[model samples]
Structures are given as C-alpha cells and as structure tokens.
Target: MASRWIRPEVYPLFAAMGVAMGICGFQLIRNITTNPEVSVNKARRASGVVENFEEGVKYADHRLRKYVRNRSPEIMPSINSFFSNPERSN
Candidate 1:
C-alpha cells in the first residue's frame, strides 16, 4: 500500500535497510546465545566446555569469511595484476 506521505522511491531503500538490520540483529542474538563469554547463564560461562573461547566463537559462527581466510583476496586477479604492474604505469 502506498502512503501519501512517503515516496514510492523510498520503499526499496527501506526494505534494504530492514534486511540489513535483520541480519545484524540475528548475528547479535546468535553471539549472545552461543558464545560463553556473552551468554546470559553463569553456568555456561564457567563450564570450561570451550577451552579456547576465540576458537569456539569462530566455530560456532563459521561462515564464508572463515573458510576463505587463506585464499587470495583479489576478486579479479588478471585486472589487479594488470593495474599493479609497474611497467603498465609507464
């Protein structure tokens, strides 16, 4: 439904912002629930279940970033190499 006060062009912007906020909120809640350091329960905080809290956090929320940590970051290797070559600058 279109409202007289809001412009139709602004709807997509609102939807994009809503989605971004939702993802951020989901991550925040996930960290609070799974990470012992941030968990609400005292028992889980002191259970010694995760010897290395950092590793545990990574494992609990493993994503594309973790899996590709070792790979080259260039999205277009050929393009990057072309621009970086000193001879090309001349």
Candidate 2:
C-alpha cells in the first residue's frame, strides 16, 4: 500500500507561503483600520451628507412607502392575486 502522507520537502514551502500570507493580511488590516480615506462615515461627512445609518434607512423606507402608496390603488389587486389566481389572463 502507498503512504498517504505529504512529502517532507513540501512542508517548508507551505510554511514560507503561510508566513508571507500572514504578513500581508496583518498589513491589510492595519491599513484599513488606521486609514481615514477608507472610512464610509468620513466620506459621507466630507460630502456634507450628515445622515447616519438609521437616518438613511428611514429615508429609504419613507421613499419606498410613498412610491407604493401612490401606485398601490392602480396595481394592488393584480399584484395581490398574481400567485393566488395564476390561471387569470394577463
């Protein structure tokens, strides 16, 4: 029967590659956390848009509600029964 273990020569190569990848990952995380240019909040504030996550969500919800309200009366019945009565003609 043949041995299923990896060859010993490949272990050092794998170790070296792992060390290099670890160093790169550490540098990437350091750059992201310390760099203001990568920050979403900073970018939004710089553009004079003071809305936070909650406010942005609220605005989106308001807009969606307004659009649905305006269009519902005209389109609601068909939308509601689209799946319920799939046999109905288009």
Candidate 3:
C-alpha cells in the first residue's frame, strides 16, 4: 500500500536528495569538530578566532594575487591565436 503512492520514477530523485543531504551533514559535523574558531573553551576560542582570522587573510591574499598575476587575460588563448600565424596551404 505504501508503494502505491510513491512512483518508481521518483526513486532516483529521492536517492539524489538523500546523498546530497548526507554530504552536507557530514561536512557540517566535520567543520564543527575541526574548525579552531569553534573552540572547546571560551578562553581558547578568542585566541583561535584571532589566529584563524590572520591565517585566512594571508591565505586569501596569496591565492588571489598569485592567480590574478599568472593567469592569461584571454578566455581561450590557444583558440584565439589559431589564425594568428596561419600557414599557406598552397
């Protein structure tokens, strides 16, 4: 009787949602456990917050600056330069 209301075609959608929810739940638990900002005690939390903030700033600066400096401005450089020096087919 329960199966009558739930169509077979909808099973995959339910499975996908379950997997997505599971992944989200796992990440939340991992972050709560491992993140320094969420310290076990109040005293440590303050220090952790400051230290993590500095680390985050440095990391962001290095990653963003490096990528911006090194990456090509063109969207598809190779394709864009295809006809730049075309060879005569004769």
Candidate 4:
C-alpha cells in the first residue's frame, strides 16, 4: 500500500485555516468596495497624490477627535489637551 504524504489528522486543521483565510479575504474585499474613503484614497494615490505617515497620522487624529467630540462631550477636553500636546500625555 502507498503511504499518503499528508496525515489524515492534519486535514481538519488545514481546512479550518483555509476557511479563516477565506473569511478574512472576503471581509477585506467587502471593506474595500463599501468604504468610499478607501476608494477615494486609492484614487488620490493613482493621481500621484502621495500620502505620507505624518499626513496619515494627522488625518486619523482629526477623525478620532471628531468622533470623540460627537459621541462624548465630557471627553472632549481631555482629547483636545492630548492632541494639543501629545508629548505630555504619553
């Protein structure tokens, strides 16, 4: 009898990993397609509008501050102070 290269016990593990990867890939595709921000950024990059780390950080900070301001008024002062002087907070 010829012996199989892969053991039978490992088949379930491989299948589970494959399923997890597929789910992750599907979620990534969904996000890329559904999010207008992502598409806009891609278009900007294609048009030679290069995005650097500092710009990305500033954008994220702006978005975070806006979200925090809307959802929780009490935390606005702390968030504002932190952004104003990030070095002291850390």
Candidate 5:
C-alpha cells in the first residue's frame, strides 16, 4: 500500500539512488575480478559500436515507416526505390 500524498520530488531521489547503487555494484564487481580491465574494455568497445549502429538502424527504420505512413500512393514506388538504393543499402 502507498500513500497518494507522497511528494513527486521523492521519485527522482529514489531513482537516482537506484542508479547510483547499480553503478557502485558494477564498480565493485569490476574491482574484485581477475582480468576485469580486459573483459570490461572489450565489452565496452564492442557495445559502443554495436549500440550506435543498432540505434541508427532503429531510428532509420522508424523514420522510414513514418514517411511511408504519410506518403501519397503515387510516390510509393519512388520512395521504395530511394530506400532500396544500392549505395545506401546496409
């Protein structure tokens, strides 16, 4: 059970605490492990590029879908061709 009268400011404080705890836990694990630097560095390096490319693809697909939704029927073929262009193909 929770009280409805709780101040909204408390939510952010709790959220921050949760994030801080998570970061501290991660650092603690990193400090106690053997070869933590190598494993963490490798993971970070791989994740950075992978996350960026994934985000780009996700946003591009989102924008393309939105464009298609708003597009006139007459321009459908041209739009499809533009997106399917070999130069831009992934």
Candidate 6:
C-alpha cells in the first residue's frame, strides 16, 4: 500500500494549498460583512428602492381608478363583452 501512495516529499504542498484556500474564503466573507459604508449604503438603497416601488404602485392605482371613473358608461358593456364574447374562447 505504501508504495502506491503519493511520495512523502509533496505532503506539505497539499497542506499549504488548503490553508491558502481557507484564508481566501474567510477574507472574502469578512470584506462583505464588515465594511460600514457598504453595509449602510446597501440598506439605504434597498429602502429607497422599496419606497419608490410603493409610490409607483400607488400612482398606477390612482390613475387606473381615474380611468375607470372617466369611462363609467362603457365599463359595464366592456366587462360584459369581455366575459361573454366568443372570441375570448380561443
């Protein structure tokens, strides 16, 4: 069994490679988690994006309501036609 195994002269090379890989992984995780400006900016940007999206939804809802009100006379016919029209079966 010993004769078929790797040579003893190269054992340290594998250990050094493992240690280097571990250090690189730890440093990458630390850089993402520990930077104060990056963390704060990320939170701020996420909240700003959420707020903007909420405002856009509200604005769209308001516009849709206004459109419905302005076209009240045609809304029922359009809805009825939408449900009963044979063309929709396709």
Q: How does each model score on TM-score?
A: 0.59, 0.39, 0.45, 0.39, 0.32, 0.35
Candidate 4: what lDDT? 0.69
Highest lDDT model number: 1
Full ranking by TM-score: 1, 3, 2, 4, 6, 5
Q: What is candidate 6's CA lDDT for residue 33? A: 59
User: TM-score winner among the candidates?
Assistant: 1
Tens-place lDDT per residue, model 4, 15-88, is 99999999999869856765434644656657664546674665456555777765745547788988889999
> In model 1, which regions exceed 4 Å deviation?
42-61, 86-90
Q: Tell how far residue 31 is off in model 1, in angstroms.
A: 0.7
Residues 1-90, model 1: lDDT tens digits = 448768989989999999999999998987777665565777766775556767676756568767788889889977887889968756
Model 1 local distance difference test score? 0.77
In the range 1-90, model 6's lDDT, one tens digit per residue, is 775777888789989999999999986775555533334465665764343556455545664577677564664686687778869745
Q: What is the lDDT of residue 65 in candidate 2?
A: 81
* Backbone clashes under 3 angstroms, per model: 0, 0, 0, 0, 0, 0
Backbone clash pairs for candidate 1 read none
Residue 77's lDDT in candidate 6: 80
- Show model 3 residue runs off by greater than 4 Å: 40-43, 46-90
By summed lDDT, the worst window of 10 consecutive residues in model 3 runs over 81-90
Candidate 5 or 6, higher lDDT? 6
Candidate 4 segments whose C-alpha is farther than 4 A from its true place: 1-5, 40-90
Q: Please tell me which model should have the higher lDDT, number 2 or number 6.
A: 2
Q: Each prediction's Cα RMSD? A: 4.3, 14.1, 6.6, 12.7, 15.3, 19.0
Pairs that collide in candidate 2 are none
